[model samples]
Target: MPVLHSAIHKIDKKPDGTPAVLFLGGAEQVESQARDDLMHQFNESYNGTAGKGWGFFHAESGAFPLSGWLGKYLAGVGDFLKFSTIAVEHLVRLMEESNLTTGGHALFCHYQQGLTEYLIIALVQETEAVTMTEELSLLTIKRLDLDHIRLAARINLSEWKGNPQSKQYISYIKGKQGRRINEYFRDFIGSQEGIDGPSETRTLLKAFSDFVESEDLPEESAREKTHALVSYSMAQAKLGEPITLDELSGLIDEDRPKSFYDFIKAKDYGLSETLPPDKKTLNKFRRFTGRAEGLSISFEAHLLGDKIKFNPADGTLTMRGLPTQLTEQLKRATA
Candidate 1:
């Protein structure tokens, strides 16, 4: 009840656009005072303990010994490892729910920057645990470890002026082997297909990736849903009518192109009068387009203007992007 009451209080708004005061249980004066005191104490205790080894722990004051704070933080790798494990679990769940599999040489990555670094750490740990699976280098290991890498960067930029050991670690990362590792990180993070890629494909991939993360759905469930959609699209393509956005939106189901175009241009609550979609809705459309495009490319399907058309009346989509070779393959698969 306390948690629920707390949530209600956070959500409740007054008519004057201010937060509404919520009394715990009732309007009892003694209970309300106690509750307020308890919340204040809890917040203070949490703040005191939260960033013990981080610079923010003493941010209220004028303390700015970043290296000192960061050094203390580096001593607590075990605590960080536990939290990273939980984060990785959630990230994997998200990937699975998005119908994404981490295979191949790890192409088509769509990880958040933090997760990208965390994965590097996990890989470094795995390499250390095994015996000579490949040639090993200390600089490579450190580069993959964000804390070590950041410490080096800070020291190089003359920001880390703390412990002598921190200086030594940076010196090591700048050594012969370390230079290569540093270059690798720079390329990986900066490339178009990497964590900070600037390509539209990357953006679409990230949008789909985020959708799964936010939904927190299971991989098998997402796979099933996508499989149904692909089958529907393939069937429509085979019938020579294909599926249009209107048909996809339940406007019409007739096996004809004109029917789809007509349904969309019907005017009343149809495509002609539809407003622009919100960002979220637009992203959904983009994701669908990307997925279909990926499938088409894989199947050697045609996707020129001749095959896929867009009607200006309602911005409706009509697609037959699957290639003839893929169509035959799909028929064989179904048979």
Candidate 2:
């Protein structure tokens, strides 16, 4: 529960006469002491209101709403700050009063003004190890490492200075990377009047790529789930490792396109996944010219001694066992 909820309720007669609090929850001794302390603090306040914001004339202050303390947003002298709406209201007032810059430039200036630059880090905390390629870079590796990245990520996830939502934000961080990235979200989004650019959210994963290149996915399986899996896996893949079949299956839908011939031709040459025949596994490979047009490449082994092998019959790539001279021509052209 938030500090705001600490207040007890009661019914009252009023000028405007609206619905009123009918009763108060039973208060413990500690709460009573806290209430008295708040009252004393309010009496000692500079404004004598013990409250933030401009609404009250002379607040007999005893713990104002969290929104009240959001008035001053001096995050640092030269820093971009993500603030709550109340803080932004103060900013709008300041911007309106200033005559120095245009709106676009002013906002940009505010964003770039932060003292230290930060990064948002996200790690698949509970996810299994996955195959992946190069990690994305914001700056040169010469300038940072995993520790630096993690620390920068932490700063990004920080939340409201005096609100309970900040605790919720903290709970989202399961480990170092997740927490770091969470920080980035808090600082970057909390203070903004807008969203970040498309490039900011861009990510890549090899397991997903391998999955798309795999032979199992159905022709009409949902693609959205595949996209999300790829995104999540990419963040967790081991850099410089070849994606495994099992790993690939987990990250993308097993969508084999409807047309078998087109699927084979497209996936064989396009994806570079080796197609071999097997009784148990799904058969999706094709050869343009062969004894078994739709047969798996592994089955071609049984017929190897009798005629032209499927591997050598790879249309125009190899210059042998072809009715036409297309492969010969390509060889000649390259030569």
Candidate 3:
């Protein structure tokens, strides 16, 4: 539960005048929570929700890291997680926008990184032991029978990293490059390999079987743009909402996948790629609602900045007495 943050703290007043964040830390720190709530209140005295929270802050660099509620990724133990880079980005952005991010990160744990699972599985094929279904199942009262295919499917379809790899499993997670095991998985396991037979179940089965037959895997790729894939996968798993096509496309930065193969998989029940007819843009009405509260505060701040006198009746802001030239300059600046 310990959080890491850069050493610098304190927001200094800037001569140019945009508000700079001071006193940075993980946003979940109770004291930081209180402070952000106060800022949200000023930003929205009329709006509700009590200004719950914001993304956590990094002190020295001032970067706000997304909160980690997605369960810890399990590594070395199994294959899964590494496939969900897009989902992870979306998760962080959603948390930041909603002001719900709490700021924690996974060094590693419980779920597998999907993108890399296959190659590692292939590499380890010769070994005496495998991370078989019996070892990783999180079965409940409702389900019976061991499920390796679906388990692998979910991890591959989900996020990119989990943790605690032993010497045997370290390479995939070596530098946190999600693309590694993932590319091969896509190239080898989850790729659109030809499937035989009718049932979607049959297709999945064929895919799994075909994967076990691929070539010896290569080295893992180096990562770019440090990602928050684990965070997103956890959010999507928890929310359980079907994503819109646009949202899905946005999530991966990739052009939408050419075929319906991902959607065709049987294990992905309740998942959706259909987009709303009127694609969601911004919600400006929500913006106007919050502006109602601090409109006066903003006006007052504006007044203080100028040596101005105001008449109660006129809606216009004016300085009662000033030299014409200076008044004109102030009016221009205000405008």
On lDDT, the leading prediction is 1
lDDT of 1 at 16: 54
Q: What is the TM-score of each candidate against the true structure?
A: 0.17, 0.20, 0.16
For model 3, the run of ten residues with the poorest summed lDDT: 279-288
Question: Using TM-score as the measure, what is the rank order of every candidate, best first?
Answer: 2, 1, 3
Better of 2 and 3 by TM-score: 2
Clashing pairs in 1: 301-323
Off by over 4 Å in 2: 1-89, 97-197, 200-202, 205-207, 214-335
Give the deviation of candidate 3 from the true structure as CA RMSD: 26.5
Residue 7, candidate 2: C-alpha displacement in angstroms: 18
Error of 3 at 199 (Å): 31
The true-versus-predicted C-alpha distance at residue 78 of model 2, in Å, is: 26
* Candidate 3 structure quality by residue, lDDT tens digits, 1-335: 11111111222323353433333323222335543433233222211111111111122211222112222213233122332232233333433443331222211122222233311111101112233367786543321111111111112212123332211111111112244433332322222222111122223223322221221111111010001122332233233211243343334324443222343343353322321111011110010011233342111122333555445588445544565986899899999
The lDDT of each candidate is 0.28, 0.26, 0.25
**The candidate that achieves the highest TM-score relative to the unseen native structure:** 2
lDDT of 2 at 228: 44
